[model samples]
Target: MKLWGGRFLSKESKLMEDFNSSLSFDKKLYYEDIIGSIAHVKMLAKCNILTNEESKTIVNGLNSIMSDIKEGKLKIEGDYEDIHSFMEINLIKTVGEVGKKLHTARSRNDQVAVDMRLYSKYKALDVIDNLDIILGTIKILGNENAVIMPGYTHMQRAQVVTFKQHIMAYYSMLSRDKKRLTSAIEIMDENPLGCCALAGTTYDTDREFTTKELEFKKPVDNFMDGVSDRDYLLELLSAFSIIMMHFSRLSEELILWSTKEFNFIEISDEFSTGSSIMPQKRNPDAAELIRGKTGRVYGDLMSLLTTMKGIPLAYNKDMQEDKEPFFDAVDTVLKCIKIMNEMLGTLKIKKDNMHNAVKRGFLNATEAADYLVNKGMAFRDAHSVIGNIVITCEKKNKAIEELNLDELKSFSDLFEEDVYEFIDYENTISRGIKKEM
Candidate 1:
């Protein structure tokens, strides 16, 4: 029988089972679920809600179940309504009548709330650690590639920038994401377990003891508000969604960089795949997947935002819909963090092609203009003179430096022999590249 079946008269349809069964996805929170229950039982004994012997029986049975689960000896019974039901049902089976008293002061309403908060707390920290690994790899690459390449704008060489500068830009964004996760965790640190079924319970429960036992920072002030607040989960997914967007942009560049047209970087073969039809193709499969998965994480945030918009006060069954999105988002971001770190660690950058690109795009023309200005010409006149020089050089089918001083002098009397020295592509690039370091 289901845990709530004692009050119901008939079995739920198979359609209902398939629609409402969270056992499949939520089973992943088994560890967090058990931990919360153990804390709850301890609080029950401390508050005199359970006799000392009863508490001992319940706690011992839970400990055994935890061990069995760790050893993979216990099957997660699927017929129960959820993880709470499954644990309670298992507790009764293990320790007999006294095991049923484990749920004395709390309802599943508060139980699930605490479970989600605990799970999110643990999951968020795991993501933060992985983020540190990703940032470390980027820092290493940034330092190594500091003098390797210059920056670009509008797909044209605008200025020289080290590859290190580009990597550090991403590092700054990830630092912001880490700060966001830290803030969200602090907001969710309160315990909601003693809230029971929305209103404060009448039992002589010790909210302080449960909060301390669960490692929560404090008890929530309002019972109804505590069970209904999903803001913490929303904040976490929002932060994750933003990070996914950053990864997507990075993935797009990685895709372009690996192509024959760019030939700027070569992703490791292990993280890539060969095209079935093209014998010569080794595609960036993992980067492309990170780009593709961005939509799913974004959808998770949007789904929850819409769900919370129309809800009334206190808890509702609609809150059950919250888990799938939050769980999917956490899993998606965690995997991306791992794959991105590994890919960046092994990826190879081609310094030669990056440098070659600098020479083709008239990247140093602005330096030519500035050279005229430094020679006592007004910047407006210098700008016009540079335009004419470019047109003259283009007509002769030559680079800017290929023009003779007499030809340059025709555009402006200020053209001097020393102006040639300031006009090299490397000079312009060096000035532009200095900002990144």
Candidate 2:
């Protein structure tokens, strides 16, 4: 039986039941729903809204259902409106009349709100758990690999930076993502259990008591907004999209690096795939899939944004649209983090290829120009001198290191043997804050 519909004479149509049903997806919230109910039941008995005997019976019943579900003795199947109905019906079966008392001071509106928040809380931490793994793996990669590579802008070699400097850029990004995920939990930690039907109940419900029982930081001050708003889910979806974007960027670089033309890194055989016919095709399919799935997570955020836009306040069925997208984003982002961590773990950095590329790209031309400025050349003149040397080198198909000291002096009288030391890629990369490396 549904938790409501005492006045309606007509039964819900079969097709309508199918359309309105959320048991397919919201069944995932069963654990959260039951946990929320247990807290609510304890508060009801304390307030005398439910007798002590009634509350004890209901709590025992709810725990039994939770235990059965956990041990696979119960299946959450059958036609049910949502997890709340699935819970109430089975609850009534387990505890008889006392189970019916479980809904006394609460409505499914607050019931569902608390369920979503509780689920989001734990699931967000699960995302963080995977992020910690990725961060640790990235730290190990940066420390273990001590190769210098070309840093780029507009896909052209711009300056000299180390492999550590490059990968740790993502370390910085994911650290911020971890912080964002953590903060989103705090913003969502207010308890919504007492906000019955939006306006709240006339019953002397102790919201604060339930708040403490549920381990929420505080009770939501406005019952209407408590049941109405879904800003927490949107914030997490936004954060998840940003995280996918970061991984996609790194995936793009890795895919390029694995190519024969770039030849800068080798993806492990485990993370790569071969073509159907061609024997020589070890495609970077794992990274490509990660890159491609980024759009899927982006779509999850956008779908919820659209669903929530123009939605009326005080809870609408449109709010049901939040769960699938939220569920999808958490799953996608966690999987992406796992796959990306593994992909990065198995990569082989081609030190020779990176160092050779760094040599030819005039990546150290800034140091070349800086050497002139140290020798008292005007800053603009120093920049101009380096630009001329690059063009001359390009025309001759020769690296700056290939130029004799006299040829370099032709550009600037400041040119000396020591200029070579300044332009060396190793020295160029040492524009360092020591502890970070």
Candidate 3:
């Protein structure tokens, strides 16, 4: 099963083989490996490198391997060097000697590069699909529950905003995340199959034929870059990191809102958990875990950056370090998206509590200043007057709205019966949204 044993007289030690083998994780690339191999085989035959009958025989063996592996007839695990070895080794064993020709113009370097690109290309699309689902769920929440709430600055109520505006902030972040992934896919869409180890082949290989057969956008122009470039992965990891950061922000708010003090929303019982000692616990474990996993995804990105930073040209064993972290990030973000979407769908929005919080926190304080400005008071003077009014209201244990006209006029002559309408939460949010238009 060792692919490079011609020059080696001594058998490889078990420990070294174990250390060097990537089949443990890269077996995840089995389907990609076989599919790329099929494309390469067909290209080889089309270019007359293999007889038509020989190409069919190798392809048949490759197809049989896929069926047997899927059906559990073949267990694709052992002391093989990697999935490429396991595959070509099995292909030869299955279809006799013709199976050896399947790798006629390919190198494991290009083979693995193509496999990883193929894997990332499709998985990125899956992540986008999940993002779309999450976006749809959030749009529904923002539309159905249009209640006004106190928007925060530095964790303190700063202004009036609707629950819709708050949730849609995440929608914006995830939408950009989807686009980042799409762009990364486009950048890595060139077919790298014929690059072959880095130097390419002397044989008259038709890379364009394989490119079209494999459904890539085009063939890679540089043999060295095709096998060596992992910029696509770094771009994708960066996108996934941004996504987790957005998830973490939303998760922090969800955890805070589910608490007794906030009482703004309730996570469903299915996503909740119990404490071992406290019988009254219904923890927002789903949101909490999502927040924690954000760090893990960040680490996945950093891990690859460190791994790829020092490695030099063409191909290196160091590149094998890339797959696990990349796969981990993909799995983490997908799970986070799925759970968050479900959690958002079943949430119980506490509109009354949200409204009460808005009122209690002087969310309309900014509106009071704007109200004075409308009455022709200088904005600076209105701001100072509102500051004093807030202090007095806090000392009196009263909201700004609770003060009567004479009490409000003591601070400023701009106060009137219409002040109530101007600072109403609904009117405040409406005016706030209108300013954007």
**Which candidate number has the best lDDT?**
3
Model 3 stretches astray by more than 4 angstroms: none
124 in model 1: Cα distance from truth in Å? Answer: 1.1
Worst 10 residues of 3 by lDDT: 428-437
lDDT of 1 by residue, 1-437 (tens): 57677777788998998787887777777888788888888888888888788888898999999899889899886676677888888989999988889888788889889999999999999999989999999999887765545466876666555677677889999999999999899988999988998987788988898899889999998999889979999999999998999999889988988999888899999799997899998989999999999999999999999999989988988898889999999999999999999999998989888777665556567888899888888888888888887777777777777778888788878888877678775565566666534
Which 10 consecutive positions of candidate 1 have the poorest summed lDDT?
428-437
TM-score, cand. 1: 0.92
What TM-score would every model get versus the actual structure?
A: 0.92, 0.98, 0.98
As for model 1, its CA RMSD to the true structure in angstroms is 2.3
| lDDT (CA) per prediction | 0.85, 0.91, 0.92
Clashing pairs in 1: 149-161, 150-160, 150-161, 151-161
Tens-digit lDDT track of model 3 for 243-294: 9999999999999999999999999999999999999999999999999999
Taking the candidates one at a time, how many backbone clashes does each contain? 4, 0, 0
Predicted structure 2: lDDT: 0.91
Candidates ranked, most accurate by lDDT first? 3, 2, 1
Model 3 C-alpha RMSD vs. true structure (Å) is 1.1
